[model samples]
Target: MLIRSSTPEALRQNNSLSVLSALRRQGALAHTDLCAQTGLASATVSAITAILERDGVIERLEQKPAGGRGRPRVLFQPKRDCGYLAAVRISSDQVQYSLVDYAGRLIDRFEEPRLGGDGATQAFGQSFLAALARLAERSRLARDQVLAISISSKGIVDPGAARLVWSPVFGGAALDFSALLGAVWPARVLLANESLLVAQAIAAQREGQGHIPAIAALSLGHSIGLGLARRDRHGEWEVSAPNFGHMQHVAGGSLCRCGSQGCVEAYAGFYAVLRTAFQVPPQTIPAKFVPIAEIDKIAAQARAGHRMAIYAFRQAGQSLGAGLARMMSLFGSMPVAVTGPGLRFFGLMQEGLLEAFAETHEGRLNGVPLILPMTGEDELVFEGHVTRALAEMDVMLATGQGGGAP
Candidate 1:
């Protein structure tokens, strides 16, 4: 376990954060509401909110009571223009950029095609940086106004410096995200795995609804992604995106994009399902992307009793289920929120998935974990961006490291 000593300055900042966190979670909470939610004294809440309002970080609203019965209730919310944030979500073929305000509202967004897609044999930093620059210009936001830039990608990322350590498309090459933007912009940089954001969104959504259970988010697409979200000792969401796709599944069995054999992705990825459906050799290289229409046609065949197609989905399901069982054994059982483009084929994968999972020792002993199929991966990802990016902004302002000379 890790521990750190708190100083006077840290304690003061934490008190401010507690007030801001209450407003964020409860949405325009009143002075008394902040006190209740944050467990802070009414005096402390008043002092913090006054400081926040004076610094232009938040604004108070006057709400009239129903039927004009009593005095208006005062509420506080983050100022819409306290600062700005840019959230970039990188996918196989495209990059999406969204400009968000301090209140975590989307102001503008656009997408641009990635240069190399999955064959990332060259640097994309030039185009990527250009896009970000364009985003700020388009939004008419100045350097200091942009408090933070949060990015997500489908690869291993460095949590602190926001580096893309290793990507399936780029192989061993890494992308220094923080440096790429540091010289051009003053905003703090944050990076997270794509699925990690998914988990964060789920966890944020579950807050205040009683206890938030530990859960795993499993994304099925061109690659398999897994993220775990649990509450920390302080009751904050702690999230991680493990390289679940590349974890070993069968010894020396099938080829993976990472040049590894018997990886879970080699069996459960979209290309793997396509390969098995077509009876392709295990040694054959997987395609970078398979059209959903093609997968749908195969699913149609599977539903029509096509032996190979049925077997293909079954193989993918078994691989995913087996991997999930091992995860449960190691991390203890938890609900799995399954999402991604691959969910369209869940109907075909359900039977084999459950069957294979039930066969595992962990599954048999503790029973299979609840598996929920969900949609809107893209929306959830952006929600995650807002939840995390705003929290960071709150701390920056509380620490006097944010915009408007806070």
Candidate 2:
């Protein structure tokens, strides 16, 4: 929000944000190039850069000789040591941690098994706090050096509270990360759905001209997750993770972990495929967790032309395709990017997926495009955390609100 009348100070802050955003997006740039890209006057650019350098948010490079006749010129870029960011990716099996610098470079990372015992949330919280301490100690960074801690999980996130409302790992047990981490770390605590981060990374990657304005990132694994990223009419990036995995796929069908019947995840999740392949009763409660090796074995069997194995995959694909159809109907036809470890089985599900997709209203009228680009899921998630974390940090620094609670 802006003032009804633009004040000189407000204009200056806005211009500073613009310059930082330009540099962050395009890397280092010369003063003239910064003015050209930001559409700011040369004088304004100089003033902003001078303040940014003085604040240590940005730094100047060694002067480079002009190609021909002009005097030597200097480039400006975000200072690598300005602040640090930590990314924590929580999955069903394990929790992964990544440390990144202000320049968005990965500094270090480690993973630990996500043990589940009594008081699962409390246990995870203790482990998370310890991990943060370890990260800071190992990296030799002071407590205040960390600008933000962005955490992602496969679950329902209360974005307003930076909390995990529900997750497969700890169903119905809400974890208020903002309050939990705030007690220990002074850095900003942020929470997002894992799939949403995937969408963010994909959106940032395609920010170049001529790219799609919106996209849907579908993460398939033991559970399914959906993240949609789109630019509003004002061209501001908005991202969200809908509980698409829990959307009903078949009424009164297989039981789901959420105590519901016929949810999309009940049919398409790894456990569902296993249950169907093994001829388990539809009413049987799903396993709390299904191992990746079990799913891989089923994939192998499906590839070997085993009728039951193939049928299980087909059923899962049908559920996914139907869910995607309904989603496109509501969100318009946005290209979907399928990711996660489960993509390895895409070949087995392609037939049923495309077949069911074609049967949908949007599929018939709009023809949904499915894009599968090869990339590491872990890397994408981390990149997404960094992209959003750093961008948020820039807004804070520019607005003089850095290190404040939301």
Candidate 3:
């Protein structure tokens, strides 16, 4: 195996990290290919690969015979069982938790009902810890194997401080989750808003596919959430400013639950649509309607030429697209990803949303790509948390810093 006495600053700071990250995104790669991709010396790549294999972070696979090469080139991939991380997504309607391996694969998943009304925080905290314990047991993973526990909440998160700044869905107050979980769990805790995490997870997965200048993700659920990812001047990936849901869409269309007038959530959120659906004065409407299931039925009816359903979806989509137009203007155009419960009605709303976007967008920014209905098996928020945790671990290991304390 090749060896190096000292690694370059960039390589030392992110040596194995850069290599592993490249492999994670591109799958198995040969040593020469890694050096070419990461701009590291051939000796450095080999040494780093050896270190990673020794630490169980990566493993060598069988070499493919090359017709012209003197010897076959060895390939390497991330060891799927290197360790585990916990991902928790806290929303107004539910709490979803999962145990994921280093490769962002779900090992187990658990979900619980969200506490309604004002006293949801304490109830959610208790349920969150309980669910985590149950999930760990189910996955048969030791507590120590859990290198980190990352949470994605509906509100703003200060990753540096590991605290919630404010969330309209949860009471408008900063929550000290680090202190709260510290009293119970024995693993490093990380907290980020759901929107940012979603964007990060998507970017992490899409790395090296091509030069995607920027990506935007819009989540349509109980509350509207937006995540934006772009590379900064220094060539570092950065998550943009969030809280796009609160942006005004109409002058005085509807009252938002956040005590704002004409916000996007007032028209695009799950409850907003359901409230409109229930107000149709139907004498036989169900007492309780599941928004997702009901929305699908409504979309199907709209497709079949139901005027009322079509009208409602159109209005909601117009309002949503207007909000997106504002984001497009500020970000100077990029790919917009529409996801979550709202996408179920994409067929009904596609035209209205496109029309509204065209009407509101001032410039010729329409050429920007837009991704609709995010495609992935695991919950995007949960996968995002797991990705963040694993990336953090990689950084710490490369820098020779110990893992964060519980």
> What would the per-residue lDDT of candidate 1 be over residues 74-179, giving only the tens digit for each residue?
9899899989999999888888999999888899999998876454544578888888888989988777789999999888988767888887656678888778
TM-score of 2: 0.95
- Mark the 10 consecutive residues where model 1 has the least summed lDDT: 1-10
Q: Give the C-alpha miss distance for residue 382 in model 2, angstroms.
A: 0.7
What's the residue-level lDDT of 194 in candidate 2? 90
lDDT (10s digit) by residue, model 3, range 1-406? 0123465755465777788777866778988889988899999888888877777777788775867657677788877777677887776667787888766677887678876555456766677677888888897876766767888777667758778877864657667778877876766788887888788878867776888878888887667889888988766578754787778877765777667777787777765666566564312222232457777776677788877777777877888777777777777677777777666666676777778887764424564247557855235766677667877766655554423222
After superposition, candidate 2 runs with Cα above 4 Å error? 1-5, 66-71, 403-406
TM-score, predicted candidate 1 vs. hidden true structure: 0.96
Regions of candidate 3 where Cα sits further than 4 Å from its true position: 1-11, 54-56, 61-73, 115-118, 184-186, 204-209, 234-236, 277-290, 296-308, 361-371, 375-379, 402-406
Residue 203's lDDT in candidate 3: 80
Query: Which wins on TM-score, candidate 1 or candidate 2?
Result: 1
Deviation from truth (RMSD, Å), model 1:
2.0
Question: Which residue pairs clash within candidate 1?
Answer: none
TM-score of 3: 0.81
Candidate 3 lDDT trough over 10 residues, lowest sum? 280-289
The estimated TM-scores of all candidates read: 0.96, 0.95, 0.81
